[model samples]
Target chain A: MSARAETLPATGLRLPRLGLPSLDALGAWTLALIWIAPLVFAAWAAFHSPRDALAFDITAPWTLDNFAAAWVAAPWLRYFFNTMMLVTTILAGQLVLCTLAGYAFARFAFPGREVLFYLVLLQLFILPEVLIVENYVIVSRLGLFDTILGIGAPYMASAFGIFLLRQAFKQVPKELEEAARVEGCGWLGVLWRVYIPAAKPVYLAYALVSVATHWNNFLWPLVVTNSTTTRPLTVGLSLFAAPESGVNIAVISAATLMSIAPLLVAFLIFQRQFLQAFLRAGIR
Target chain B: MSDTDSLDRRRMALYGWMLLAPALILLTTFAFLPTVTTVWQSLFSRGTARRPAEFIGAENYQYLFDDPVFWQVATNNLIYAGVTIPVSIVIALGMALWANGHLPGRGFIRAAYFTPTMLPMIAAANLWLFFYTPSIGLIDRIAGLFGIGATNWLGQPETALWAIIIVTIWKEAGFFMIFYLAALQTIPPDLREAAVIEGASRWTYTRRIVLPLLMPTTLFVMINAMINSVKLIDHLFILTKGGPNNASKLLLYWIWETAFSYFDRPTAAALTVMVLAVLGLVAVFQFRGLEKRIHYR
Candidate 1:
């Protein structure tokens, strides 16, 4: 504000000058095409049959055969089940953990709270992937290896999630909580009646991010899981793609497409909401 | 002894621990436990089945110090981080500048640029490979039309890492640009107008007026870009696997091999601890820089 004042507009306008907006629009379209080309390619590859893929022809007939072949090539059904189970478990855990943690940070009177909170947030700086090698042993020791819970358990309470929810919880009016307290409500009652409902948008926002992130997750599941039976989509796709025996590009593309299809469909269906969710996620 | 008071106190204790439980458990198991174990494990030079393993106290790190592979891995990581971070930032800034400047159908453009960020590395798994496929592949096809040779991108050791760097830059630039775009919007338009009226050169306006104002955002974006690049590069599994004589082998991938392929779990742990330390050091540089520029925030 001060910087703008220092160069005071004296007696003139404040509006920034506009250039050729349409020219920019053209450039924008070109750049957007470059960015989306890979996605377009994957779509093209996934829909085309294997035989047509070899021919350098744009006029190849599209089919669901790749999807069908991809489906039969691996246990995509088991992969989906494991991935869904993993995501759901982790999201449910994070919501409960982050919400309560966020609430405690926002509402309570406690000693060394900020210190403890910062300690938890430190995990945000250090990713579990950096520690995956050691974590492999830890999981092995716990006998949790190859279990869906083992895969999902490690990321249940993200520091980012806690931080986001805490910010949202803090934004909820303290007066509302106090009013509930004054109306003969107990602390739990006040929290239930006031805090949770008020922070619903944040809850939804966190859920979308959690689901998207966990669905797309690879490294942790890669290290922990050894079999397709328990592996998520990323692991399944990687294992399916491992072509030390000369990879079939079309089939690999088919596997890749199948692996990410659910999320891709979800994104297209909820593009606007997904964009907002990502806008918030970028802050993380 | 009143029921209300007792229940209140009990509830308070319960909520506190309950709130703390999942995060603490997950963090302890995943972050803290592995870290601690990695440090312990690094102390042993636990060998292959050919040799019985025993306590070797810093020998793995000792080898890591002398072993040229570690240095190569370190160099590759630096190269990866170096190319991916700054190039992506520049591309992101340019995209944002163009998108922010005066774009009609900006929403369409913004969405278009951001489409890559939405793509899972897995979804675009073979996309880069195919794009880098010489002669007929997309990248070379464009280059070929201009009479450029089909460069041995991933095959040759010299250009292998650079090829990976290009893909990383492409994937990440759009993602980082969003943050810059967000930051750019926060800049008031009036300042630009005033600068324009002064007949400032485009470079002069950006350098004097826009750049200083964007210092904090730039710093934040740089830190994020650096951290993400260092930590979460599972794409290497598909693209290179630290390949062509470990030329593209990253620290994380090295740790991965140590644990899984070689079955040297202990050294893998130690290397992980090293990765954490290296990343922490990077964060320190970032934090100190941010302090100087954007202390208020």
Candidate 2:
């Protein structure tokens, strides 16, 4: 009903056409700046001397000493290797496990199928994060504690991955599977030939999400891995920046930037794909 | 013929189970079995060299309830969730409306917003650690311009939780905006045209046509944010360590402390059970509420 008052335009005062849209743009840019200021400041601090960094001195001479100091302080290369191994191992496991389980749920007719699917879905709620205490115990009991495998094991059989694949697989035409089966193909062959190709996009989306997630995962890995041998960049960076370590802010910024640089660069380069993958994952 | 059919059915069932076996085993090992064992472990007393562990049903829970730190942490978590979820969602909604609109520098704005989501929470926390440091920090440097003294944002009990809340909002709003943006794209453009043609103001258009359409997305984001409030405690390690006397301590942080730092497994298990109970309630709401409302045309 108030639309009438807004639409009337009956008031004698005429505002500039540029007024409202410019106001909106102003608001957007402000929020964007505030949102990004911390990161920008971190980049600034990483490049400048510690005193100059805190001073916010625009004329300060840029230097690389902080990066050098940070690099020498920790075994960052080993941490990167561990993180890479952890991400790759988890993705590979999720791919194999979710694909098989998803195909079974999508195509197979079996007893207790619904029950099994619900059980898989239950994992969505009973996440490893919440059950950390027992998961730690289980990891220790299985003699995998302090290993990358222990860090990666709980996340490998992801319900979200399975659910996404099942949805993707179910959308494939039955005729395609029938065509493959007519060539005397077994179930495995049909899945390999027909189903996997059809669900490739879903796999890509799930992989992007899984990689980003495990790369940033901290608490479980922190609990499971005690030494530099198994620490991911995240846990490693946390330790490097710990208050007890007494690392200077500038050096911590450098280490922080270096640790996130790979993902950040990948995100910038494949910005479209990253956003699309998040959208694809989020909507489901 | 019937005998052959039954045999074939059995073979198919067996094959299906084999395909599902790997995932089920992992899920059982990690998710299902642990959930049961966490509950079971919570009912026991901590065993020391002098005594073997025995089932002290409800005693650990009693201890948790009696501990004032538990209550403080729980309350802190509630405030954290209560503040972060709606604030981030609202900011995200505003961001989505702007980015999805006819704004200049839209791509740069969107990128600036989303870059935080790509950073690890620990990295974000590290960056903010400098911002929140007393006296020589960013906030103090800026406040100096206004003749205001350096305030200890993360060092004091009063403002420490609020400081953490601000960082959480910054990290999350942009991520949540992606969902809102996706939802906005799916909103048919013709509806906006119709609303404008009907003499509706921009605000009216959003309230009448857009917000209702975005309800499912909002619900989805709300559920994710709720889960995140429970899980996203990485900042506590860097920013506060639940410190200044447990002022900013959250539930998950406390659980980690109880389990790892304090070496009290039973108490930690009890806290985990409580978190699980909260999550379970959310799960039911999501399945029931989301499943029905998500059938958008």
Candidate 3:
């Protein structure tokens, strides 16, 4: 709002004649600079050698010591394996559970359904973090503590997943499902052949979001797992990067980069689809 | 046909219940059960702040009223939300503006902005901690270049909360902007086009047309931002640990401390209920504000 003072000429064509009113152009330039700086700095620290990274000088000697030192600091391979197991379990369960729950809520006629649905929506507000202590007690009692399942279990029935899929399923049109049923297709067939395909985009979007979110989840894993054996990438990476032991900036950035490398690489490959998914996540 | 149809109808109802079993059970056990347990456990007693628990009516609630830490934590949440919400929303609004224009490399810039929001607080917190480290880290070194001496960010009580607020904004702003970006796209192109036809300045068009169309998104964004302010504290474990002196301690972190650290699970439960109450009220107002502005058409 502050950027426009001289470019309005009372015509739609004026914008082209004016070339973005100068100030807005400058404002855009400045915002881009501020937003991009930290990640660029992280990249510089990650790729450059330690001496170059640590040197107060802007231009200095660069080498591969930072990456090498960062790599040797801990067993990142194990952390990656643990993260994979953790994410796969959570997503796998969410897919099955959310689809069923979503389909039921959307299509079925049942008693107390609205009340049950209302209670379910409340989960979206009272995130698991608020009730972590109670959750800890449950996980401990179940003998799931320190197991990958413990890390993935509480998140298995995602309210967000159910809600998103429900929205998609409700839009699938009742007539189509009825016709399929009349044509001798079973209910399962209608779901698999009709509802599921109709909701594929929502499913794809939900999958992207679920993976991005759970992959980065920390508190649940921290509460459930103690040892590196079960700790996910975030927990393991934090242990190595935390400042309590006085970590150096250069080495820590290298570790941070290595940890996020998979997700970051995935993002680079499916950048457009990922951004579109978030855009469609509908302000949540 | 009639007999089989009756059987099929009956079976479908049974099948619906079967399908809902896993998700309904899991949600009830994990989410709904804990919420109910928080209220139930809060009412029970532990018999002397140091003993095994028993049912005690409202005693924990009464204690919360008397406890000085409750007020302190509430105030800290206010401060955290106060800074984090507006800063994030404004930054997001600004980010959206920047990207909406024909800028150089806008896509790459948007990705850079949105990167931190993509990371779970755990991973992102590690990256920030490295940046905020005392002597050789990025923030201090930049301060050094400006002739300022290195200072401990998370180590001190005075700067700790502010430090957390800054990082929280850094992580969240871009994510909020994605909503704004989507909202911006939906604002009728004709409104802007008509405004330009009327010689409305770019600033004027945005202030009057774009911003209003985006108000619902803003309200929704701020509500989530407020809720995040109250809770998102896993990152606190690695970054501030809630303090050298509880300076950076947030409400939920303190609840965590009370539950596990002090073994005062009853008080923690009471505190959890209080936190939920406040969040509920904020959420109500947030949604109400959004509903008022929502242009469903």
| For every candidate, C-alpha RMSD to the true structure in Å | 4.7, 3.6, 3.9
Question: In candidate 2, which residue ranges exceed 4 Å CA deviation?
Answer: A1-21, B1-5, B290-297
TM-score of 3: 0.90
Give lDDT tens digits, candidate 2, residues A1-284.
65434432311111225445567778889999999999999999999999999888889999999999999999999999999999999999999999999999998889899878877887888879888899999999999999999999999999999999999999999999899989988999999999999988788888998999999999999999999999999999999999999999999999999999999999999998999999988887
Candidate order (TM-score):
2, 3, 1
Better lDDT candidate (2, 3) = 2
Please tell me how candidate 1 rates in CAPRI terms.
Answer: acceptable
User: Candidate 1 — which pairs collide?
Assistant: B242-B249
Give the C-alpha miss distance for residue A162 in model 2, angstroms.
0.4
| Candidate 2, CAPRI quality class derived from DockQ | medium
lDDT by residue (tens digit), candidate 1, A39-110: 677668667765565443579888887777677888989999999999999998888877777777776655
Using all chains and alpha carbons, the TM-scores for the candidates as numbered come to 0.88, 0.96, 0.90
Candidate 3 wrong stretches, greater than 4 Å: A1-21, A48-52, B1-13, B45-51, B283-297
Predicted model with the maximum TM-score:
2
DockQ in order: 0.42, 0.53, 0.45
Preferred candidate (TM-score higher): 1 or 3: 3
